[model samples]
Target: MRSVLVLSALILAGFALSFAVSEYTLRLLNMAVIAAVAVIGLNFAFGYAGLISLGHSAFVGLGAYGLAILTTKADWSPWLAAIPAVAGTGLAAAALGYPLLRLKGHYLALATLGLNVSFSIVASNWIELTGGTNGIAQIPGLTLAGYKLDGEQTFLWFGLAVLALLGLAALAIHASRLGRAMMAVRDDETAAAMTGIDVTGVSVTAFVLSAIYAAIAGCLFAAHVHFVSPDDFNYAHSITFLSMLIVGGEGSVAGAIVGAALLTFLPEWLRVLGEGYLAFFGLMMLAILVFLPTGIAGLLRRWRRPALPPQDTAAGLDGAVSR
Candidate 1:
């Protein structure tokens, strides 16, 4: 019931913003929706399964390039291309996860970081395939019922719909047994193993799920911008995605969305500060980290806590006087 309300509110809010904002703002909103999708996926890996992956952007890049290559080179439809691109990325993650998941903490982080760098190197060097730094251009936009969704407002609506569906899916997973197992594994792998949970299987599942989400985001990016390049999905993007997950509230789906929106618009908002905008932004983020350690969602949750009723308060006061 709560999830339904939240999803409805999100959709309604997106519609409201579409009417309220400029085209550029709508485009930014679309990007936020896209980023939210990726960040929610990251929550599964980093927040639930406790995987420190710095290579998430690579999975996103794979999806984008996969779609780009298929649609451009193979003359396939965008819809048809997305299936192979997303599924293949998931498979790649599952395959890589078996070996990479063995490393823990910073070791895992570095391994994934190396993976992102390797992906960038290949994308940059493989001029014939990736178009090198120039990127794949003139890519086609997505169509629905023969109506091309090329406008920023139309794309924003489509992206919002996707984000809503995926967000609901994430919420469902968060309430399931698999979600609990992932959290348990995150808390303590040895304890989870002692309780008969397959730690490795859970980790790989989380990684694959995150990869699939990243793939969807990548596909959206390709369709929206009609371009694919290594620079767009670099290590910096992975770091930003991770930061979004953390800033939104590590384990919460709502947090992912909120964090994505906040970070997406923050720099733009700070630009009003001129030359010292970045410095102010950094300090503001630091304040958030220090004061709201659990992120925006955490702050909301705290605010939502029910207060004691007047009768209950009176009874407590009377009991204290009697004592």
Candidate 2:
């Protein structure tokens, strides 16, 4: 099916990029892959369901800390730790969703922002568990059939494989009944309620799904770098994730991935601008926002659309004149 082609194309793209880029760039690409997973999750909450959650990084932190603690303290396998890390984050989201989802608009946004701040504070003070600001280290990396996957190239391969699979899952969700309900609730809550859609339930489901994706990204981060700190998943990171979604085109899955990659490498690309790079970068983003409000994906979509023939246009005008 189309999903298979997408998956294959993504894998092939990663394979091609591996040879075309440097080792350092590969590391950045790996990070982008991890971030793409989280951003795609954000697409569910914000893009599809119109739930503006600003505490997404907190879920990522929970997952990273969860795996770090398990692998370090209990000597559990990274693969085994991921299960609880992801599931626990989802559960936490569900528990928090009902009360939090009650608030609409900026109120909900503030609540989630508060959640991220609170998570950062706890992660910093919880010396025994999260290692305070020092973070957890010496965590083990993944292995496949006795082959170690610790190198940048190897990790990129693994990250790409994970990203492709999750990408497909996100696509599936976008086509499912739940996805439709989420969109309906997003478009108009009152109308959706009138149609018998469980607005609250849909919102909660979207939040939890987003959290699960964040957790998976978190686990990958923990395993990849073998270290994690409160700073790694702070409110700033949540903002960056949101920015990725916006710049990539919020409602589209392809847009999310494209945005994640573009933003991830953009700063590096701008490094040639010297110390003024950030200023220029900000201006560029501003321009993109002003002119292409639909994001890069939207622009690409516009380019891909075929133009009507001149005769067809004239015939359409003639028909309108006759009418």
Candidate 3:
């Protein structure tokens, strides 16, 4: 209940703020919301399931391309196209996850990274399908009841609604038995397996779930930008997604949202520092890492708790005597 309230408050705040901000800011917010969805998905794999996936961008690309190809080539509606695109992306993840999830740590990371590179190569070379380096343009925007969400402000609201529903779903999963199983695997796969948990299955589930979320984000990206390209979903974006999870708080839904918003807006906010902005940004990130190793969510958790009073040895002895 508390979690729901917190999430609702955050969503309400964002919705309210959207009206007060400039169009540019609203656009940024939309991007942040999209990124948040992907980051939250990453939290399932990297955070809960302890999977290091650099192939996340590839899944997003698959989704974007899937939607783009369906809507443009097949003349399918955006709403209808999204279902197969997202599902196909999840299926791809499930198919690849079995073999890839066996690798641990850097091995898994490298494998996923290679996957993203391969995806980029195909997207760039397959000119007939993905539009090559030029990308697919004039893709249709999303519509609701004959009203097109063509404006940034309107789109932000729609994105926010999507984010809210997905966020709640993620929170529900986090508190479920499966979520605990994933955490168990993360903490100790050997122990999890010994306790009757199917570690492999859990890993695959997490990967597939993450892919589905990425696909959703990709669909939204294509619809929002009306463009799909290889450059937009690359290895760098995968790294950025992981970075967002780390910066926000691994294994936390709120942390994912916070991290996405922070990283998305940080660059824009730092632009005021002139040419030295990037350097300062790096330093700021470093400071956060050094001081708040558990991320912003951890710091907030600590801040919310009341301090305990110091215990006296005499009182302890008295209590002991009474017992």
**Candidate number with greatest TM-score:** 3
lDDT of 2 by residue, 222-310 (tens): 99999999999999899889889889988778888888988898888878889997688678778878998778777876786545435
Mind giving the per-residue lDDT tens digits that candidate 3 earns over 221-266?
9999999989999999998898788889888888999999999998
* TM-score of model 3 (CA atoms): 0.93
Clashing pairs in 3: none
lDDT of 2: 0.90
Clashes of each: 0, 0, 0
Q: lDDT scores for all predictions?
A: 0.90, 0.90, 0.91
Candidate 1 lDDT over 191-262, as tens digits, reads: 999999999999999999999999999999999999988999999999989878878888888888888888
Off-target runs (Cα >4 Å) in candidate 1 are 306-323
| Per-model TM values vs. the true structure | 0.92, 0.91, 0.93
Instruction: Specify the poorest-scoring 10-residue window by lDDT in model 3.
Output: 314-323
Better of 2 and 3 by lDDT: 3
Report the number of backbone clashes for model 3: 0
Worst 10 residues of 1 by lDDT: 314-323
